[model samples]
Target: MTCPPPTATLRPGQLRDPFRLLMDVTARHDGLVRLGRGPLGVYIVSHPDYIRRILVTHSGNYIKGPLMKPFRTALGNGLVTSEGELWKRQRRLMQPAFHVRQLQLMESVIVAAVDRAVDRWAAAAETGRPVDFLDDCIELNVEIVLGALFSTSIDPARAQRLRELTSEVFAGLASKVWTFFLPSWFPLPGVIRYRRAVAALDAEVHALIAERRAAESTPEDLLGLLLDTVDAETGAHMSDQQLRDEIFTLFMSGYETTATGLTWAAYELARHPEIAAKLAAELDGATARPRPTFAELRSLEYGKRVIDEVLRLHPPFPIWFRSTVAADDLGPYHLPANAKIVLNPHMTHRDPAYWSDPETFDPDRFTVGRFGTEQRHAYYPFGKGSRMCIGERMSQTITQVALSAFTGTFEFSVAPGFEVVPQYVVTCQPKGGLPLILRRR
Candidate 1:
């Protein structure tokens, strides 16, 4: 049997920057490239066909892989981290909450959250203070997610505290993914901090759950849906622990990913005033009121393309992993049982073979009627197949609404000499935050 393409061993310095290292390896090898040695073997799949095979066609041959293990402490068996029948059950129970029709019900709630942020940003713009654009996105997204889930707004102080803690916890989890050899049970300072952060986040989620249970009425929000959902097969409802885990998982997965997407949209728009102007024009023409309704959001074609391009350029979850359940042949390579595979959308989306002018920030690449068949699997920001993000529709709606509100009301320019570096923590975030000057339009 033909051996897989030779593994690209990492140099010591390359280990420090895995994203760059992976990019270099993908550029050097063909569609399939193996890395590392022994039981730690990794196959980095870059081609869309192989990606489709692994994530979709042959999905049952793999599972969530080892990379997601560390996140279990914080995420529990919630949809994002869980596997097997449990994942299916939770996904089914929570699926309706993200349906387009269901999300439309929360349109006013989303608008209210965005309005609150716009009010704050207007004040900042008036003062001529440079706002951390990414931080602002985070706050707005956190508020939006919480309000959507609970149908109530959280205290600003408490929301800020939860944001910091969740960031710490996820950063710790990302570090653990990179340093797989380090024992999480080692009780290092970072590990201790991660535990504390998880505990704090859990406390907040549990408190919300408790308050909801004791209240006289619960709105038909996500939390209420999860609490009310009963399994068709077993006729069982989620327990309090299950509810807490799912709620926290949904909050973390939904908020951070959406915020990251919006942040990158803002970053890209600020960098390209021409594109920003187009988006602003589309937003202005799409609505006469302060906020667009759900139908109006669908009409903002240019705005949607801008967001699609932003997600293509900077996917929040840049890397995904899956492990082989048994020895099998993949393309020209023969893989042994339990071999790890890495799917890098970051590399695939930028592959020159699929995207013209891959390095350029051109939203027109996503313009309707311009994309080709190959682009289907070439751009998977929210992933593909059965395990695709259940929150994809809601995220898109949240991002479209938030971006329209902010870009329509204000003009944003990056702070002079501010360099944007992509930091791959749990999510790819703009390093040092995105500082921008906002002027009310």
Candidate 2:
């Protein structure tokens, strides 16, 4: 005997601070609540038992659903948007790209990007100009992802153009998140902008793919690795369209989630200068001048905790969405077929039941004895279950090696009087980009 959940009514303007509003509702309702009206209503779930049930226990009965419909519109049927056999095949084909060997290769790319960032930061420090942490991270992740994918094969200007085109595409797609509830026939400005951006993006990506195919060389870069990979059962390479889908997905995932994550980490690091100082000392002691190799950087145990704490405070993918394939029971609540669902890591991470001083910035929470079973369930910035992010290892490595190298090179603190607000877009980026001042340590 289950019951219909309580509705958490929120006015349109409350979307301005959805993090707080949603958190309030979820906690007040005992971690299960409803939002919006009929047909467009979403059931928000934050409890660990319920989260694991939906994401792991009954994952087979869930599909990408309405939330990812817009992603499909933007990304074709990439792993993030695909379902059934197509998803399984694509996931298998792409798995090797994030293998241990590949992550080793990415470490160098991450370090190189950090070095380039350090050079720019040194200039900013000398001039005493505050840098927008979000903007800087966006640029940094773009460089790192491209470097890993194409390496020296891409020209700087060409990479910059890709960055520009990607931003256009992201902006257009973001505008559609809300407008998508409207009928497709409606000629909204967002849809128009989205189509135009998609056209330009497709042209650029397809042109690159065609060029790579025509070339006689098959290098060991990510693109080459992807090109070389074949379906084990079919022994067939991914079609050009599939490649485009995967590549586009990678750029979106690689750029938005990581860059936003680094921004939030920078915010907390800047806010707590004492913590930042300790991190700098730990990172400084971890590696040598110029750059920290992946192996040496990973040796810093404290650095790992800082990264975890950053993500715990600000999970990039704050909301995970799914829909029921059939009628199902989520804890004590009954969800009908096709019911929209949201598994909120943001609320779960900050739940007072799981975290003491949930609002406090604390890395020690993840220490040896502390981060046990409950904590694991409460923290999933990369998601959980079989559908968890494929690039999880590489993303962590990028955060680890890049943060260590950059912090080791220079000390950074948030500029005074600048309020850091986690602006929810494709991911959680600082609203208007948080400002931080780099100093010569």
Candidate 3:
């Protein structure tokens, strides 16, 4: 019986900055390393083949790991954190709603939402004031997703409240990741706050569900789709609680990740004028109209690449987790049953072996015929396999529309002395927000 590589015990300070520590370990150990010991053991797998095996090839042999256990209170057994038969059922029922044809129906909502944001930025640009691009992107994404999903818009006060509450919930959840062994009922301040925030969020979701339920005519949206979908085997529909969990999961997963990706893209574009210019030119050449149609969006090849490059550099969910259900062989390492496995897309994305000059930001690396075939698994921002993000098409469309609108109308540069650092909460966000000065294009 071959043993796994020796565990590399993390220093106390290293635990506080898991991203950096994990990256260091990946670099030193050639993309596969063990950390911790015995019951608390974790294997960090960064190689593409290992990631493919764990996520796709032998996925049934694993389950969502302890890292996601902390999120269950807030996210419940929705697609983001659920496993087993329940996940399979939910995935089947929800799959159609995110299909490409269904997503096309929401394109107008996306365009309108982005137009509203562009109008807001136009005023800011006219006043020569800097805007927090990250905040604006988050707001735009939340509104677009809400409109697309429910055919409803959140008022400013409600939107602000929801934003604050969700932020608190995410912060609280992130605080518990490393200390996942602790019981949620332990009455810790962070845990208590997380529960409260979840409750508040639940109230909002329940209100939406009630509103939809009471409607005389069901709208053509994701909410309606969920309310109407029936389990063929069980002949039952999602209960209110189940509806709340799914909606809440979609609410967070749908908006936050895309918002972060767009925010990073905007930040990069602002910092790199040449790339921004090329992207804007591509958009301009694609269509003379204010908004690109679904066909036109596909035609904006460079714009798509820009978004891909941004996701590669700053994946919203930086690390994905899984746990082995039985002892497995991961290359030379013996992965024991029930051991935690961490796949760091962030580290693998920047590995010198896979990406040349990986630290530099170059959109051209993703250009057609330039992006090599060797890095297929190396570039999965939405993850890979059947469990890949269901909202992948919707997210890309939202970002593409938002980017076209923003770049077509304005040019933004990062404000002086504004340091941008990736803060890993529930997602990788730009710390202190992305403050940028805008000029009308």
TM-score of each: 0.94, 0.96, 0.94
Q: What are the clashing pairs of model 3?
A: none
Once superposed on the true structure, which residue ranges of model 1 sit more than 4 Å away at CA? 153-161, 181-188
User: Which segments of candidate 3 are over 4 A away from where they belong?
Assistant: 38-40, 153-161, 183-187
Query: lDDT of model 2 at residue 13?
Result: 85
Predicted model with the maximum TM-score: 2
Summing lDDT over every window of 10 consecutive residues in candidate 1, give the lowest-scoring window: 180-189
lDDT of all the models against the reference?
0.82, 0.81, 0.82
Q: Which scores greater on lDDT, model 2 or model 3?
A: 3
> CA lDDT of 271 in candidate 3?
82
How badly does each model clash, as a count of residue pairs? 0, 0, 0
RMSD of each: 1.9, 1.6, 2.0
Prediction 1 global C-alpha lDDT = 0.82
lDDT of 3 by residue, 1-441 (tens): 666765788677787787768777877887689987765567898888788888889999878966688878888988988888989999988888888878888877887888899999999999999999888888888787777777753466776677777777767777776666445456565666778888998898888789888879888888998999998889999999888889878877865788888899998888899989998888789889876888888888888888888988998788888888999987777887888788889888887777889988887788666688766658778888889988888888888888888888888999899888887776888888898899998
Residue-level error in angstroms, candidate 3, position 350: 1.5
Model 1, position 42, has a per-residue lDDT of 78
